[model samples]
Target: MRDRPEAAPGAAPAGVAGKKSGNWKDLRARVLSAAVLVPCVALCVWAGGLLYGALIVLAMAGMAMEWARLFGFGLETRRGQLCLAWAACVGGTALAGHWGGALLVMVAAVVLGPALWAGQVAIGCAGLSLLWLRYMSEPGAGVVLFLVACVALSDTGAYMTGRVFGGPKLAPRISPAKTWSGSIGGMCCAVLGGMLIAVMLPGALPGAVWRGALFGGLVAIAAQIGDLGESALKRACNVKDSGTILPGHGGLLDRFDGLLVAAPMAALLSLGAAGGIAFWYVGLH
Candidate 1:
C-alpha cells in the first residue's frame, strides 16, 4: 500500500487548515450581509407604520417560500402557491392590526402542511407579535432595537467563544458544533449587551441591573432554543440550510429563527405584565 503524505513540521493538518479557512470566509460573508441587512431593518423599525409593516410582509413572504422549499416543493408547485397565499393572508391581516385573523390563518396553514407546521405557526405568530410590539406606545422602537442587539450579541458571543475554547458539545444529536462554553458565553454577552443598549436608549429600561440581566438571560435562552429547534428541523429534512437567498445567512428563516421565537416570547411576557412590555423592561410593574 502507498504511504500517506506527512505534514511538514509546525504546519497544521490539511483538514484543520481547510476548516479554518472556510470558517473565515463564511464569517466575512456573514459580516458583509449583516452590515447591509441590519441597517435596513433598524431603519424600518425606527420608521414604524407602513415601512415596518412592509418589512414584516416581505420577511413573512420570504420565510414562507423558504419553508416550502424545505419540504421539496418548488415555486411552481401547488404547495408553493398555497404557502404564498397563506403568508399573504397572514401578513395582510397582521398589517391591518387584526392579530386574531392572522392567527386563524396561521392555524389553517398548519393543517395544510403538517410536517413542519409548528415552526410555520411560530414564525407567523412572531411576525405578528413584532408588529404589535413596534406599535406599542411605550418604549416602542427602543425595546425592539435592544432586543435585536442582544440577540445579535449572543450569537456573536457563541460563535466566537466556541471557536476559541472548543469544548464538549451542547447537543451532539441536533447541533454538533454548539458547546456549553459557547452557550454560557452567549448568555453573558446577552446580559451585557442588553444592559448596554438599555442604557444607551432614551428610556427607563431595566431600571435595575438585576432586572436587565434577568431579561437578557431569558432572551438569550429563548434565542438558543429557537436556534436548536431550527437545527433539528433542518436535520430532519436532511439539509444544511433553509435556502440560499441570503449569502452566508443561508435563508431568511435561517437568519431570523431566534428572533422568530424570541419575539413571541417577549410579546407574551409584555402582555402578561401589568404595565406592559415597556413597564416590564423598566421594572415598573
Candidate 2:
C-alpha cells in the first residue's frame, strides 16, 4: 500500500477535478439550452395558434420517444407506441371543451405505451392540457403562462434554499440533492406567485384569497411530485436523463417533466362553475 503512486503534489485530487469539470460542463450546457429554448417557447406561446400547437405536437412526439427509449423498447415497438401516444395527446385536446371526455382520453392513454403507464398517462395529459389552455382563449393563455412562471419560481426557490440550508434529504434514494427545506421554500414561492397572479388576473384567477393560495401550493406540490417521479424513474433505469436532446437540460422530457402533471391538475381545479374550462382572465371581464 505504501508503494502505491500518489497524484502529483500540486494537482487537484481526481474526484475533485472530475467534479469541477462536470459541473462546468453542466452549467455551460444549461445556459446554451436555455438560451435557445426559452425564447422559442415564449414566442410560440405568444403566437397562440398553429405555431404553438405545432411546436407542442413536436414536443409531445419527442417526449414520447424518450419515454419509450427509457424502457429499452426496440425500434419497431417505440415507433408504434410513440405514434399512438402523440396522436392521443393531440386528439384529446379537441375534447378539452368537454372536460370529462378529455380526461377519459388521457386515462386511456395510460394504456398505450411500452412501459411505465404512469409516465405515459402524465405525458399524454400534459399535451392535452397544453392545447386546451392555448385554445381556451385569452384567459386560458394567461393562466398557462402564469402556471409556468409559478413552476419556474418554485424550482428556483427550491434550488436556492436547498443549497443554502442543506438539511435533511427529501428523497435520498431517488434525488440525493433535494431537501425538505427546498420543498418548503418552493411551496412558499408558489404561494407568493399565486397571490400575484390573482391580483393581476382578478376574474380570470380564483377570486378568493384562500383559493389562490390553495391553487399555487397545490401546483407546486404537483410539480415537485412530477420532478421526483422522473428522478425515481431515472434512478431505476440507471440513466442520467430521459434523453439528450436539450444539451444541459438532458431532454425535452427532463425540462417539462414537472409540468407534465402539474399543468393538468391546475387546470382541473381552476374550472369555473359556469362550465368554462378556462379560468376567467382580465380581457374577458
Candidate 3:
C-alpha cells in the first residue's frame, strides 16, 4: 500500500480528528451565542402591548448607555441622563399617541440634544431621544417589525453571499468584510423582505408595493452605510468589540447600528407617504 503523506506540525492526527475539532469549536461558539440570543429574541417577539413597549424602552436605554460608553463617556453620570432623556422622548410619543409633529419633535430632540448639551450628558440624552422617536413614528409595530426583518435579512444575505462568492471588496478601508456581490445580495434580500411585509400588512401601512420596494432598497443601502460608519468609529477608537454584553453579537451598538439609521428613515418615509393622520393620533396625541 502507498504510504500516507506525513502530517505537518500542530496538525490533527487524522482526517476525522481535524474535522471533529473544527466542528466542535463551531458548535461551542454557536451554542454560547444562541443561549443569549434566543431569550432576547423571544422576549421581543412574544411580548406585546405595554410589556413589549417596556422591553423596547429598556433596550433603548441600554443602547444609549453603550453609545455613550463607545464615545468615551462615563457610565455612572451619563447613563442616567441618557435613560431619562429617552424615557421623556418615548413618553412624549406615547402622550401624542401618534401625532406626526410630536414624533418629529422627538426625533429632532434626539439629534440636537447632543449638540445642545455639548458634553457627555447631552450626547447621552440625544441618543435616547433619537431612539424613542424611531419607534414612535414608524408604521406601528408592523413597520418596525418589517424594518428589523429587512435589516437582519440583508445582513445575513450579505455575509453568506460575500463568503460564497468572494468578489471584490466594497470598501477595503472601512470594512474589509463588505463585498460588491454581498451588497447586491443584501439589497435584493431587503427589497424582497419589504415587499413581503407590505403584502402581509395591507392596512397597517400606506403606499404602493413599488414604493415599499424602493424604500427597502434605500434602507438597505443606508443600513450598510450605517454599519460602515460604526465600524469606522470602532476602528478609530482602536477597539476590537464595542463591549462584552452579547456573546457573539458584541454589544447593543454593534447589533443596532443599522437599525438606528434605518428605523428613523423608515419612519419618516411612512409618515410622508401615509399623511401622518394615524401617527398624529397615535403618536402625537
Best-performing candidate as measured by TM-score: 1
Better of 2 and 3 by TM-score: 2
lDDT of 3 at 39: 68
Ordered by lDDT, highest first, the candidates read 1, 2, 3
Q: Which prediction has the highest lDDT against the true structure? A: 1
Per-residue error at 97 for model 2, in Å?
A: 8.1
Tens digits of per-residue lDDT, candidate 2, 142-204, equal 667767767766776776576556578787666765789889888888888877775676354
Q: RMSD for each model, in Å, please?
A: 6.6, 7.8, 9.5
In model 2, which residue pairs have backbone atoms overlapping below 3 Å?
Answer: 204-280, 204-281
Off by over 4 Å in 1: 1-14, 277-279
Against the unseen true structure, what C-alpha lDDT does each candidate score?
Answer: 0.74, 0.65, 0.55
Per-residue lDDT over 1-285 for candidate 1, one digit per residue giving the tens place of the 0 to 100 score: 000111122344357666565544567777789899999999999988899888988888788888888788768998877776788788889788787888888888766658646645876888887887888635778778867776777887887787667588787677766788888888899999877665666755446466667778888888888888877777777777788877777888877888878888888777765565552354355
lDDT score, candidate 2, position 48: 79
The residue ranges of model 2 lying beyond 4 angstroms of the native Cα positions read 1-25, 74-118, 202-211, 272-285
Q: Residue by residue across 1-285, what tens digits does model 3's lDDT show? A: 000111222333456565334322333443587577756654654444555555555655566556556566545765446643654455445544544544454455445355323222322333333334444444445555666777776776675575557568776565554678888888888898877776676464445466557767877876787677767666665665566676555676666677656765655554554344222122322
TM-score of 2: 0.76
